[model samples]
Target: MGDWFQTIVDVQATPQEAETLAADVRSWLISSGIVSAEPTHCVLGADVGHPPGPRAETAVDPSGWSVPWHDGLAITVGRTVFDAGQGDPMAVTCPHCSTTTHLADERFELKYEVWEPFREVVRGWDEGDDIVIACPACTQPVEPTSWRWTDDYFVLAYLGFTFWNWPPLRPQFVDDLARHLADHRTVLLEGKL
Candidate 1:
């Protein structure tokens, strides 16, 4: 399991609009000092180009969706793109009952397939479809919110900012990003592998 967190902004724009939005996001990253045009003080001490290296799904240490759909328009911090399950992934507490459900526990193994749905459903979800996943602990139909139990197993989008091992995204950042992309739909995805 990997501790994966991504801030995905669904671009319903045409190709040109997408490019424009990407540029704006890049400018925001540079101006806000979140990232630098030139390598400043980062873990690797070098300007790691877009999409960096070593894909995350290869069952390797620190791999992710590093495809360079837009060359200079991706945000990846730290040497590792994402941390492995941040230790114990899928350990969620039922909001309705407050009962913690360990998804990885042998007892709840039944919900494994249910949680990880088909890739296309995930894509629809990323596009703003409301998907409810049941909690093994209380059997509550929970919707995805931050690190909640309905957290997406996969998301398909053209633009995403992945924070490796970072805590649930700060509200200010979410608000700011939402403000910037007012016309497009934005979804915060918490990934665990």
Candidate 2:
């Protein structure tokens, strides 16, 4: 079986505030015994991350397994494009008009004509550009990040916390974390690699 990961992304944090927020969150997590204070090579892509602490169980659902399986918390602080690891988003829904744009056809073939603009915007967003796309139906310009994706597939943000192979987190735990984040909006993305 492949590895699984769950990421909690701060959708509202600015690039300049990400590092500070990350530091604060790390401190809180450590003091709360959710993760260890010392960093180690416990994450997939990152060189080091905070391993699960003694009270790691407090963060996950009571019914789920509590064992520390693979890795730990990896905080990314920069303009980044966070997506589901393996598959592409099938469609995007415009926030303004509630219009849906399909990126793939009935046979799962990519619709290049519809997807090219979004692809470019995603690239620009990753590179720190404030790119916006015009909705085909509404003809209104909107931030790509504001559009809803299939299965909540993508998020453009400056801060994200990726937990590798951890149990499903508790909703209360996520809410508490968001509170520590100055009430910023967060998105939970889960995928397998």
Candidate 3:
């Protein structure tokens, strides 16, 4: 199910906030009996504008309530973030569709790399399955119900084979390589630690 995890990924929001939300969700999952118990581990992989800070603060209402309203199957194909020693494309044009998307200059200084393997495994997506993504980075024409933009990353929820893209949070995506990750922390209150 590598493709499943890769495709079901999300991004945006302060890393601390995202991690807290993930933890809350995990708690809910355990309390609801959907999972075994207080998740020993909860992982939330996301695309962010920067690497997570050592001491990022979380908000009071960090839990994202929008999930119930949207499908989780979404993908964001941002311009590849390359390393300092590499030559990254100034702009990328989708070979299959000839659609082009631009990248900002800061992304050049940032060490960005196309983690397709991570995307593939986390979202469980493989090629040739009608993977609907955005035009250049993640150009997949999907219903609004399928995807959306949260803070900075694209939040998507897919049903079976259908794919979706989330709307941008406020300002349009600032750059191509801007991505972040939120790792989950588990706490046991009842059973299954």
Q: What is the clash count of model 3?
A: 46
Which 10 consecutive positions of candidate 3 have the poorest summed lDDT? Answer: 184-193
Candidate order (lDDT): 2, 1, 3
Task: Report the error of model 2 at residue 82, Å.
Answer: 0.6
- Put the candidates in TM-score order, highest first: 2, 1, 3
Number of the top lDDT candidate: 2
Q: Comparing 2 and 3 by lDDT, which wins?
A: 2
- Provide the global lDDT of candidate 3 against the true structure: 0.27
Worst 10 residues of 1 by lDDT: 77-86
TM-score (all chains, Cα) for each model = 0.44, 0.93, 0.23
Among these predicted structures, which one has the highest TM-score? 2
State residue 152's C-alpha deviation in candidate 2, in Å.
Answer: 1.7
Question: What number of clashing residue pairs does each candidate have, in the order they appear?
Answer: 6, 0, 46
Model 3 Cα lDDT, one tens digit per residue, 1-193: 1111212233333333544444454444334432334212122233321211221111112245343212222223332211112233344344345554443255454223443322332243333232444443555454322332222132322211111122222211111112222332111111010
Candidate 3, residue 67: lDDT = 31
Off by over 4 Å in 1: 1-4, 11-16, 39-73, 76-107, 110-149
